[model samples]
Target chain A: MARIDLVDLAHAYRPNPTTDADYALRPMNTSWRQGGAYALLGPSGCGKTTLLNIISGLVVPSRGHVLFDGVDVTRLATEKRNIAQVFQFPVIYDTMTVRENLAFPLRNRGMPAAAVAARVGEIAELLDLNVDLDRRARALTPDAKQKISLGRGLVRSDVAAILFDEPLTVIDPALKWELRSKLKALHRALDLTMIYVTHDQTEALTFADTVVVMHDGAIVQMGRPNELFERPEHTFVGHFIGSPGMNVLPAKVEGRTADVGGVPIALGRSYSAIPPGRKIEIGIRPEYVRLSSGEGVPVRVERIDDLGRIRFAKVRLGDARLSVVAPPGVRLEDDRSRVSFDPAQIHVYADSRRIEGDA
Target chain B: MDKPINNAAWFLILPAFAIVLFNAVIPMMTVVNYSVQDSFGNNQFFWNGLGWFQELLDPSSELGGRFFASLGRSALFSAIVLAVQVPLGIAVALSMPRSGIALALCLVFIAMPLLIPWNVVGTMWQLYSRSDIGLLGWTVNAIGIPFNYTNSVLAAWTVLVLMDTWHWTGLIALLCYAGLKSIPDAYYQAARIDGASRWAVFTRIELPKLRSVLLIGVLLRFMDSFMIYTEPFVVTGGGPGSVTTFLSIDLVKIALGQFDLGKAGAMSIVYTLIILAVCWVFYTVMVTPENKGARE
Candidate 1:
C-alpha cells in the first residue's frame, strides 16, 4: 500500500496546449493517504476519469509528477507502478476459467503456483464465485464477470492501490446496491487505498469517507459527504450534492445586512468593506428552508410534490424560483408564502466561491 | 383459444428461395442427373444407374486411381496454404498500423491483390515465374540455383503455393485486422494493469476474441483452395507432367479435354459433398458455447 500524490498535475490530449481550454485536467495538487477510501465525483467530461488514470499511471500528465509514497513514478508504466484498475466494462479473460482469471495477476507477478492457487481460492470464495470457479469466464453473468475483475485486482497482495472507474454501470440495478455494499465491506476488511470515480452522488456518498467534487477539469471541493452537502465550497458543489440541490439566490451585501431583492436580511456574522464588482449569493438547502409568517422573503407557491416522506414545495420569490422541503404534516399557505432560511444553514458565496471567513 | 397461424409468413421466404433455386439448385440438379446416367450425343441419356459411381470407387479403374491422386493433391495444397497463410496473415495484421494515413495506405495495399481477376492473377504469375524473362526466376537462377517452375515438380508446387499465398493471404490479414480493431482499448488497458506479458495478452485476450473471424478466414481459404483451378490451370496448364494437377483441374480435363461427362459429374458431386462436410465440421467446432447465443 502507498499514498498517491499528484503534484501540480495537468494533462492535454493535444501535443502543444497553449490555452487552458486545451487541457483535459487543470493543474492541481492532492494526495490520497494510504488505506483511505476516496471518491472522485463529477459530471460527464469533468476530468474525474483523467485524474483516476493519472493516479493509476495509465496516463502521464503533461506537466506534473505522480509520487507514490514520495517516490517519483510519473513515467512508470502501470505494471511497474503496481496499481490495479477495474474498468467500466467487466474486462476478463474470456477463454480462461474463473479460477485462472483470478490467478492471472498473481501468476503474472511471479508468485509461486501453490500461493497463487491459495490466493485465487480465497478471493473466489470472497466474491461468491466458488461454484463457478471451473467455468469459463465468458459464460458468466455480467455481475459475476465484474466480480472476477475485482478478484483479479484483489488477489495481488503487493498492489499499491485499486482504482474503479464506474465499475457498476453495467450491472443490473438490483445488483448494483449489493455490489456497492460488498465493495464497501471489502474496503473495510482489506484497508487498501481505493479511489472510485463516479458521477452518481449516492454511490460516492455511500462509499467514500472523503468525496472529491470536480468541475470543468478542476476539483471544486474535497470534504466528507455531510460536509459537502452542508458546506459546499463552490456553487457547482452546492447545486450538485443534494437531491434537489441547494438553492442559490442573488443578494447585495453591505456591512452586516444583505438585500434579497428589495427586502434586507441580517447576516449571521458581520462583514466590513465589501467589494463592488464581486458577485454575491446566499444558498440554503430545501430541507432547511421553512414556511414563515412575519419575516423572510415572500413567495408564491407554484407546485408541491408529495413524496412519501417529505413534501417538496416549489415556490417563487420575485425572480428566483426555489424549492423548499417540508415535512408531511406541514401545510403551505397556497397563495402568498414566505420562506425563512436557517441561520446555521445559510451559506454565502462571492463570485461562485464560498466566502469562508465571512460565512 | 388458438391464435390464427399466418401462412403468409411462409411466403415471405419465396424471394430468397427463388434466388437460390435459380442460382444453385438448378445447376446442382443438372450435375446430379449427369452423375446417374451417360449422355451419348443427340441429348440421349442412357440409364447407367450406379455404373459410373462404381467405376470411380474402384481403385483398379483408371478414372478411380486418377481421381484419388488428384483428391490427395488438392488436400495437400489446401493444408499447406492454410498452414502458411493463417499465421502469416495474423502476424501482418498485428503489425499493421492502427490509424492515420499509414493505416489507409496499408489497407489499400493489402486489398490490391484480392481485387485482381483470377485469370489475370494466373497469367501474371505464369510470366513472372519464367526463368528466362521473369524477375523472380532470373534472380533465383542468377543466384546459381537451377530453377525452372515449368520443368521441376518441386519448383512447380513451390511456385503455385507462393502465387496462391501472394494472391489470397491479404484477405485473411484484412479479416484479422478488422477483428483486432473491433476490440475496445479497455481490454488492453486492463491487461496492462494486471501485469500480463505480451504473449499472455495475445493468447488470453486477443486470440480468444479473434476465434470467430479466423474461422471465417479459414472457411474461405479452405473452400477456395479445395476448389482451386483457374490460377494454377492458367499458369501450369496441369503441366510438368500432371505433377500440379489438382482435383478441379483434373475434373475440367475429364469433362472438357476428354469429354467424359459421366465421370466428371460424379467427381464434382463428391467434391461438393466433401467441401460441405468439411466446412460444416469446422464451423461447428470453432464456435464457442457462449457464441451460440450471438449466432441465434
Candidate 2:
C-alpha cells in the first residue's frame, strides 16, 4: 500500500483552459493515507470521476504531480502505476471462468502459475465465490460478476491502491447492502488503500472513514463522517449531506446574535468583525432544530413528514423554508409554531464558506 | 386476466405468404417435377422413376462423377476463402481508426467493394487478372512467376481465390468493426489497470466480445463462397481442364449447355438440401442456449 498525494492536481478535457469553469477538476492538494478507506463523494458531473481517473492514471492531469509513496508518477500509464479500478458496471472477461478471471491480472504480470492459483483461491473465498470458480463469468448474475471485477483487482498483491467508480450502480438494491458489507469486510481483512467514489450519502458515510465532499469542480470538505454531520465545512456540504440536509437561512449577524428575517436568535460564539458586503447565512441540522411551545422563533408549519422513527416539520420562517424535528405528541395551534436551534450546532456561513467565530 | 382471441390477425400474413409461395414454392415445385421426369425438345416428357437420381448418386456414372468433383471443389473454395478472409478482415478491422473524419473515410473505402454489382465485380476481376494487359497478372509475370490464368489450373485457382477475397473480406471487416464499436471503453481501462498486455487484452477482452459478429461473418462468408458463381465463372469460366468448375457452374452446364433437365433438376435439389442442412447445423451449433452459455 502507498500514500497517494495529489500535489496541486487539476485537469481539463480541453487544451489551454483559461478559467476555473473550464477545468473538470480544479487545482487542489490532498493526501490519502496508506490503507485508508476514503470516499470521493459528489453529485453527477461534479468531477469525482475525473479526479478518480487522474488517481488511477487513466487521465493525466493538466497541471501538478501525483506522488505515490513520495515518488512522482504524474505521467505514468495505468498499467505502470500499479493501481486497480472497478468501473460503474462490472467489467469481467466474459469467456473466462471465475477462477481464470481472478487470476488474469496476476497472469498478465507473469506471476507464477502456483502463486496465481493460490491468490485466486484466496480472493474467491474472500468474495464468497468459491462455488462459482469454474462457472463462466457471463453466466453469473450481475453482483457475482461485480465480485469477480473486484477480485481481479484484489488478486494482485503489489497493487498500490484500488479505485471504485460507483461500482455498485448496476447491482440489485438488496444486493447493494450485502456487497457493501462484503467490501467493508474486505477492507478490514486486506489493509489496502481503497478510494470509493459515489453520490449517495449513506454509501459515502457508512463505507468511508473519511468522506471527501466535492461540489462543482472542487472539494468543499474532507473529514470524518461524524465531522461532516456535526460540522459541515462549507454551505454546499451542509446542503448536500444528511436526509433533509442542513437548513440554511439567510441572516444578518452582529456580535452575539443573528437575525433571521428580522427575528433575533442567540449565537453561541461571538463575532468581532463582520466581513463587508458578503451574503451571510446560518446553517443548522434538522436534528438540532426542535419544535417548541412558545419560546423560540415563530414559524408556520407547512407539513409534517413522518419518517416512521421520527417526525420532521417543514416549516416556513418568514420567507425561508426550514425543516425542524417535531416532537411526538406536540400539537401546533393553527399550524403556527416556534422552533429552537441548539446554539452550539449553529454554523455561520459568509458567502457560502464557513466562518469561524470566537467565544 | 383472460385474453381475447382474434382470428382476423391471421390475415395480416397473407401478403408475405403469397410472396414466399410465388418466389420459392412454385420454382421449387417446377424443379421437383423436372427431377421426376425426362424432358426432350418441345417440352416432351416421360416418367423416369428416379433414374437421374440413381445415376447421379453412383460415382462411376458421368453425372455423379461430375457432381461430386464440383461439390468437393466448391467446399475447398469455401474453406480457403473463409480461412484467409476471416483473419485478414479482423486485422483490417483492428487497424481502423476509432473516430473522426479519417474513420468515416476509412469506412467508406472499406464498404466500396461490397456495393459493386455482382456482374460488375465478375467482369472487373476477369479483366483485372488478364496476363497480357492487367496490372496484377502483368506484375506477377514480370516478377518471373510464369502466371497465365487462361491456361494454367494453379493460376486460375489463385486468381479466383484472390478475386473472391477482395470482393467479400470487406463485409467481414465491417461487421467486426461494428462489434468493436459496441465494446465499452471501461473494459480497456480495466484491462490496462489489471496489468494486461496488448495481446492479452485483445484475446481476453476484444476477441470474446466480437464472438457474435464473427459468427455472422463466418456464416455469411461460408454460404456466399459455397454457392459462388458470378465472379469465378466470369474470370475462370470453369476452364483450365474443369478445375475451377464449382457445383453451381456444373449445374448450369447440365441445365443449359447440355439441356439434361432431369439430371440438372436432381442436382439442384441436392445442392439446395446441402446448403439448408449446413445452415441448420450452423444455426443449431452456434446459437443453442447450451452452446451460447458455454462460449459466452
Per-candidate fnat, comma-separated: 0.75, 0.79
TM-score of the B chain in each candidate versus the native B chain = 0.93, 0.94
Lowest-sum lDDT 10-residue window in model 1 chain B: B287-296
Candidate 2 Cα errors over 4 Å, as ranges: A330-333, B1-12, B288-296
| Per-residue lDDT of A26 in model 2 | 93
Per-residue error at A157 for model 2, in Å? 2.0
**Cα lDDT computed for each candidate against the true fold:** 0.89, 0.91
Task: Give per-residue CA lDDT, model 1, range A186-245, as digits (tens).
Answer: 899888999999999999999999999999999999999999998999999999999889
Top candidate, metric DockQ: 2
Off by over 4 Å in 1: A292-295, A329-333, B6-19, B288-296
What's model 2's TM-score? Answer: 0.96
> Which 10 residues in a row give candidate 1 chain A its minimum summed lDDT?
A327-336
DockQ for every prediction shown: 0.59, 0.62
Deviation of model 1 at A170, angstroms? 0.8
The residue-by-residue lDDT of candidate 2 on B15-94, one tens digit each, is: 99999999999999999999989999998999997899998888899889999999999999999999999999999999
